[model samples]
Target: MTSLLAILIGCLYAAAIYMMLRRSVVKLVIGLILLSNAANLLIFTAAGLERGVPPLIEEGQQVIAGTAADPLAQALILTAIVIGFGVLAFAVVLIHRACEVVQTDDMNEMKGTD
Candidate 1:
């Protein structure tokens, strides 16, 4: 399952990069979102896949130490999600303003004084 997830994430990353190279602002924003999701999935997969085990320690369970899912990766992914959302929001607003002010979304058209 982890290997499958890794492959899917790789594919998503490739698509994101391709979208980022396109000429449309909307596509670029979507590409950034896809890239962020791919990164989050990669982090989650790197933490390993365990079965039938709760993350928290139960009372009187007497389990072995250091054989549990890494919570740090989950925390990091949450942080990355919040940060990515902020970045996406900012990018959307910036793109909207750019389109409004310049009357065009094309980067080539924004160039001037050359």
Candidate 2:
């Protein structure tokens, strides 16, 4: 399962990168979303899959010795998701304003004007 997840994450990352290189603004946004999801999945996979005793420290509570899920990775992924959403939102607004002002989605045309 880990290997399969790794492969899937790799494919997602590749597709995200390919889309990011395209000239379309919408494709870039989609690429950013895909890249963020791929990164989250990679982190999740690295944190181990088998569930064991919870990390909580309390009376009669014991931590597992083997492949336990890491909470830190999960936290990191959550943070990344929030940040990605914020960035994507900003990008969308920026793209919308650019389209309104410049009247074109072609980045090359925008660059030529400068």
Candidate with top TM-score is: 2
Per-residue error for 29 in candidate 2, Å, reads: 0.8
TM-score, one value per model: 0.85, 0.88
lDDT tens digits, residue span 72-103, model 1: 88899999999999999999999999888888
Scored by Cα lDDT, where does model 1 land?
0.86
Stretches of model 2 off by over 4 angstroms after superposition? 60-68
Residue 80 error, candidate 1, Å: 0.5
1-114 in candidate 2: lDDT tens per residue? 999998999999999999999888878889999999999999889888877665666667575455555789979999999998999899999998987887888777766764
> In candidate 2, how many Å is residue 75 off?
0.8
lDDT for residue 5 in candidate 1, whole number 0-100: 94
